[model samples]
Target: MQLPVEIPGLLNYWIVIVLMMVGFFVVISHGNLVKKIVGLNVFQVSVFVLYITMSKIDGGAAPILDDAIKNYSNPLPHVLILTAIVVGVATTALGLALIVRIRDAYGTIEDDEITNQERDDA
Candidate 1:
């Protein structure tokens, strides 16, 4: 008899889900713009992990063509994930730069505080 939730089998999936939720909650629940940017990065990483996990095959070797190897893990997804990570890093840098500018203009990085300050200025 097997239990519904097998920790060994689903550990990686569960971890990914937890990371995704943490990122989502941080983005939605945080008042700080910098924290939100960090959360977005976290979410991106979880997506990368998911892709990498799906591409991995048990007892599989590298994608290099080899007569000695019958099973090879697909490399396309890993390549895509690498590209996505580069994009994500660039995006996070842009977000941080914007946050710095916002902080300079509003004197606060908190979302609500910035909104209130803008309202008062008008």
Candidate 2:
């Protein structure tokens, strides 16, 4: 049922856009690698929300092969989302591990300090 002058139930995308912007800001504005990974996580979470939202068919049934309604979201998007989630987790883990290693190597987690130390060491 479309409204006379406005679209019905269109409040989800704003959240995604906000999350996307926040993630982008965090990733770009922050100097710490850990903070960067945190931002990346927020960014990935927004993508996950976008994917799940795409999978939800309005007034549609699940993807079960039943004998009733025949509408369901395509499985490929969902599968891809699942795989993406796994990849995001792996990436975060690897990034965090690298940050820990960097902290150990430079004795500081601050990006400026690390760069300055590297210059001094060289």
Candidate 3:
């Protein structure tokens, strides 16, 4: 008995969609700078998963030259994701550092509180 929709085959896509929506919701609904940064990282991870999912091929082998291997998985997406992971780490670190500075100056990381403080000062 076969199901009309193949849940197993499309599981990765479903996961990506869920993660993307979760990340987007967190980023938009939270006012804390640190939470926003974390949300951005989550979103970035979802995109990484998306690319990796798109690159996968069933029964595919590595791109190494071989006489018998007919289908080879493309390595470009994996390589790009590796680079993106490094960049994401760097960006996260920078974002956190800036948040630290903001906290130091304002004594709080909440966006609304910061704006209110600024208005009070002005």
Using all chains and alpha carbons, the TM-scores for the candidates as numbered come to 0.89, 0.84, 0.86
Ranking by lDDT: 3, 1, 2
Error of 3 at 57 (Å): 0.5
Question: Top TM-score: which candidate number?
Answer: 1
**Cα RMSD for candidate 2?**
4.0
lDDT per residue for candidate 2 within 1-122, as digits (tens), equals: 22356424555677788999999899998888899899999999989888877776666566888888578766667899999999999999999999999988888888888889889989
Reference-based lDDT, residue 52, model 2: 75
The full ranking of all candidates by TM-score, starting with the best, is 1, 3, 2
Predicted model with the maximum lDDT: 3
Error of 2 at 29 (Å): 1.1
* Model 2 segments more than 4 A misplaced: 1-8
Instruction: Put down candidate 1 lDDT per residue, 1-122, tens digits, no spaces.
Output: 23466447567788899999999999999999999999998988999989988887766688877798888888999999999999999999999999989988878999999889889889
Compared with the true structure, all predictions reach lDDT values of 0.88, 0.83, 0.91
Candidate 3 runs further than 4 Å off: 1-7
